[model samples]
Target: MAMGHYVNYYRLEMAQQREEEGEEAGVKRSAQYMALLTGPGFTGHVLALILFLMVTSSVERVRRKGFETFWYTHHLFILFFITLMFHGAFCFIRADTPPYCKSSPGSYKFVLGSLFFYILERTVREIRARLPTAISKIVLHPSKVLEVQIKKSSNQHGDGFFRAKAGQYVFLNCPDISAFEWHPFTITSAPEEDYVSVHIRIVGDWTTAFAKRLGCSFDDEQQFWIEELKNRTSNGVGGGEETISGVGVGAASGSSSAVAMDSMAFGSGASLMGGAKQRASASANSLQLQRPTEPTITLPRVLLDGPYGSPSEDAFNYEIAVLVGAGIGVTPFASVLKHIWYSVMQPTKIITLRKVYFFWVCRDRDAFEWFQDLLIALEEQNLTGFLEIRSYLTGELGKEEMDTVLMEARAAAAAAAARHFRNKHYYGGGGGDGADVGNQGFEGKGGEGDLLTKLHKPLGGSGAFPMEVMLGEEMNGSNETLSDARRDRDAITGLRSPTYYGRPNFDKIFGELALAHPQEHGQVGVFFCGPKPLGKTLHRCARKYKFKFHKENF
Candidate 1:
């Protein structure tokens, strides 16, 4: 571009010469200037191009090795700006005067309005990000993603003085990692959550090193489950005060643990405040231990700036939302989804949301653990009709392989459920199925403790969708073996939506959504937070069919 501009400048000068003297007269220049330009300018341009390539060569390689290389090399743009400013300040020809008039061009001349503002913006950003912040929580998800929840000090609200809308992002600066480096991360926590949170994927050197500063890694979930099972074993005969009939063993043991936990909560927080233990006791079922078996490690300090708007924040404006996310790209949508959940959980603030369709596609089953608890809590809220989550596991596996994996997972969940129910029955009296024990009668039990009557059995008969989605057939005694097999399979992976294989068909999804909500009557907002190619596909589909498309590409 600079060469083109210089070429045009010479052309204009030659045209002026041709007009001043007849066409016979030609343009003239000093041999000294010509020699210098022809020799050094040619060499300089070539060398600059070579240097550019060298800096850009194997970007992925350098990116993996260190982000500082990418950062420092990109700063070479300032040198280019400086050279161009000097080049513009000097002119080789001038027809308006006998001698070409040249001096340092006004400093303001070198400053493009946008560039000045940009530099100013960055300066402000540095100061803002320098504001001190404390890391309240650091969750190392099973998928090697780090979520940092930062608490901002405020004069009021006790939550955060820095408020950010859903789908917005912020710049995180951890001086411990690098004093100069500032990384942008999408805010994963909803505005409803007091603190700001960012999900960082450990894919590059900077991120990997940053995550290590927390000094904790995600332990194997399987080991945790094994330890839990070991702890559930009865220490005394007759299970020492069993409660319910079928799931009594698991419940009674869990109750003893719960009482011990409540006592610990009260003891630990007794001096802090009376409400500390009460608050801890209230969330006993939240799965937070009174005292974590692993000691909590002190994490390094972090700083944050901004809550810049992204495409996803607009989703709240629409009545219907269809969110598609792939792997770690799902950060932006996490905030939106959390906002929706918050709306449902706290109904004081009116929410205009009618429906939310979230489709998350990841490569491995292990990735699902990140949001599994949140998804289950939302499902338990009976928002099935409002918020539909479609998760896809894209892996090369046979039909039998997938089913076998799901069955094993379900068996583990079932065992955990039985234990939970036993604890609930032993402590107070609520059934594990979210049913109130007061409604379940003990009139026939010789009052033999309280017996939890099973309601709407998935297996005990009464024809309830057959539990097995593979075969929709009404099974009779003739296919008793098949029925048993289906029931067992269904119990292994019950009501939770099944994970599908491969990518989702956008056409099928849009077509179904279109049929469900007419375009002429209602507008559908299709939100995508993923790769550029996927967004392009969605954009094409949205344009071909009439749905408003919004995207947040990382």
Candidate 2:
């Protein structure tokens, strides 16, 4: 009886273990299915989450302070949390499925690891807010731009100068009695250089003061003579007697510039008194204790935000690249050109890029002169042969000139489309299904034939009558045909033919470049950072030429 009982117990244990394994397998399968659905196929879900967040936030703000103040205090956290939860769910589902699990256990581990990193990144940002202030010193002094240099730093041995890409900008802060105010200035230095610099045009209120404060003068100058006379009288023997004598001398030198110079000389006296008074008053004002001394004009505390941009090295792989900049739009391309030069010319890893064209539109020579040195240096490196620079002045692009440019661009696009169509028919195997080839076919009737052959037919490719095509015929046709067309007349009359107007033909540029350097390998990638209209035009043109385009907005 004891032996039989032990045998039964062992069998029961085995059965329980098998049941646990089955449950574990189901859990894994569920996780895997979730991941696959969410990965690329569930983009709609992500968009829905975004919309939900937007609506929820709007509703919450309306409840808080009515619609008038809703625009000011809408918390963005509603949208942020919605997206976070959706993204997390997406990743969780992708890790446990059959196909995903068929790989080694290492793949599952990687998904978990990425999730860990995401959590850590958020945690660090949360802790950062409680940290101490980053800025150490603030200066509020006026400085004139006496000279500008666009060369590498002299001291390479130090912590290495902050390297900047061509078009990136830096913020400069000048301390005032109120609070620190910062101005953004573009860096003219290329990425390969050790140091960066900016060229500033003295046009603002601060710049004007800087010029007056920092400029030097000769003693023979009217202002200097008055300053010397004042010093002499101040030091003369007998205080009461000297005071009378100073008044007499001041009366004699009766010039406005002299009076202005004297005022500046006395300005230092007031500053000294101000400093002393600030020290005495510090105990009463707690805020003064946090402020730094030395009254710096050029603040040493600069906050660098980003090396922000898309991949630049990818441009080297393209056969043809076109860069267009209007005014300051040239900034991002500066980084691109620098990347190309280093990647192609470096001895260790030489990648031969084919051709680059740059078109810069500016109002005056001064704009070009700002970064002309860098352009000249690039030309000197014998890179100009591979690069074309065209400048269009404001007046140079009038209505007639713009019209011509647009026409040329369009013509180029049409020609490229024609070539692409020809190539597809001859070499690339014709379209698998008979479809409308440029405003030719209607829905439902499928045919199998060459596109060119269909284009030549008198019926113009489709039997299911196009509403617009029948409109003119019906208007002039017999009364019987008009009655039949009257039922659908609105649809026919409303239809408008597609026209290519105010559009850029990017196909011409891409096709010409491709033809010029057929030996160059890899896919064409076009990057554009500009105004909306220009970017849209380039995108349309790129599509025509079959080149990939990426656009970034400022």
Candidate 3:
């Protein structure tokens, strides 16, 4: 009887537990139903789509006039408000839903749909805010023929400039002009530097205007003068044929070489030339050069946003690095090389790098001259042995010229090796037999000391190159001898052959490199930043070579 009573008590407890579970499940379902009714998930998504169309239509109108005008201003505020409303509605819905709702089968479907809407909304916002609105002080401004280097403050901590990896870009806002507009520029300085620098070439209206405003000489002034003339006519100079002719002649003549030279001298040349000639004609009947007494340069308030690019960490693991740079594309490589140099040469650790080849293409001697100092320093450090520096002067460099340079460099290297072998044999305790010592001496005796030395010495043989070669050869030999050593002690486990080529036909270069270095399949990475065609070609080549390609467009 007692056992039956105990069994009944257990049965009753089980039934009660089941009832509680059923009630809890019912409560959850009710909560979910309430959430679906109140939440803006579907409703908000529809509203966002409507807002996207509205914003896109408004953009065309905003762009037609000016991005800073009332139409643009009103559109921006309206878009912002709509986005906020949509965001708030979605948040309210998410909050009201039970946590278990997230586990429902339909949840993933909803999320996928919501994600698309989110991306679209965010993208539109980015397009609207394309112009950065912050201001950064100009740190350094260096003028070059093709571009100007403008260094400015960064978002990084401390007074020091942010360290940007190779291929990264920053958006600059000149608040002094319009706070809504921002221009993109790649960082050209080394990553270790305290200040960031960007090399900007005058290109479009915005860039050209910015360059002119920054006092870089370019064709922008002429274009600006033309634009100013058009503006005046549109503003209703209400005149007859004579007045129109006067304005046309004035604009044309004002943009002439004389005006350009005058502008360069006075710095206010654009403004002065842009003013109606009638006004100037009344002031003085004579053509005269006027220089502004006050400084004309008004530094724009600058703002920096983003350091976007592929990460540079990939280069750190590379045993051999080959950097191919065309024109200003060399900027990112500069940063990469700098990082490698510092990381490898740090006093606290000993990380040996095998080789780094830099193939730089330029248009003239002046182009080479720009980075000449940096190249010289690298060469002096014997870094050039590991780092081969080759320059192709594309403007005047024909196939023959390029071939000649390559031949000369190769012959110079071979001859130096031969002479060094002879010297070792003659001097004793060196690595050669004394076969050519007599011949060398005889050649040296013929009043050809300078010629013999030149022929015997390596190209750029100011002692650094030979020392580097010797050390490199020794290291290579040591690795061979230590092949049987423990893996931890192996220094050359993954040594790669050096890449040497001059003005390789871009069409076949990728395929050739890929075929020869099949092991590079997963290990190699390619970076291209230059003319669109060259960049595209490299991208194709990278695919053929089975290399990972990272491209940064300017």
- Output the number of the lDDT-best candidate: 1
Which ten contiguous residues of candidate 3 have the minimum total lDDT?
479-488
Query: Per-residue lDDT tens digits of candidate 2, residues 296-358?
Result: 122112223223344333455566666766555565576666666565466456554567776
lDDT of 2 at 445: 15
Looking at model 1, the pairs that clash are 251-422, 251-423
RMSD of each: 12.9, 27.4, 20.3
lDDT string for model 1 (260-312, tens) is 11111111211111111112233323222222243323456677779788999
In model 3, the clashing pairs are 135-302, 136-302, 136-303, 161-194
Q: Please, what are the lDDT tens digits per residue for candidate 3 over residues 199-253?
A: 5654445665665555544455434433443344323332211111111110111
Off by over 4 Å in 3: 1-163, 219-296, 311-313, 344-353, 363-366, 396-503, 506-521
Instruction: Output the worst ten-in-a-row residue range by lDDT, candidate 1.
Output: 242-251
Rank by TM-score, descending? Answer: 1, 3, 2
lDDT value for candidate 2?
0.38
TM-score of 3: 0.45
User: What lDDT score belongs to each candidate, Candidate 1 first?
Assistant: 0.56, 0.38, 0.43
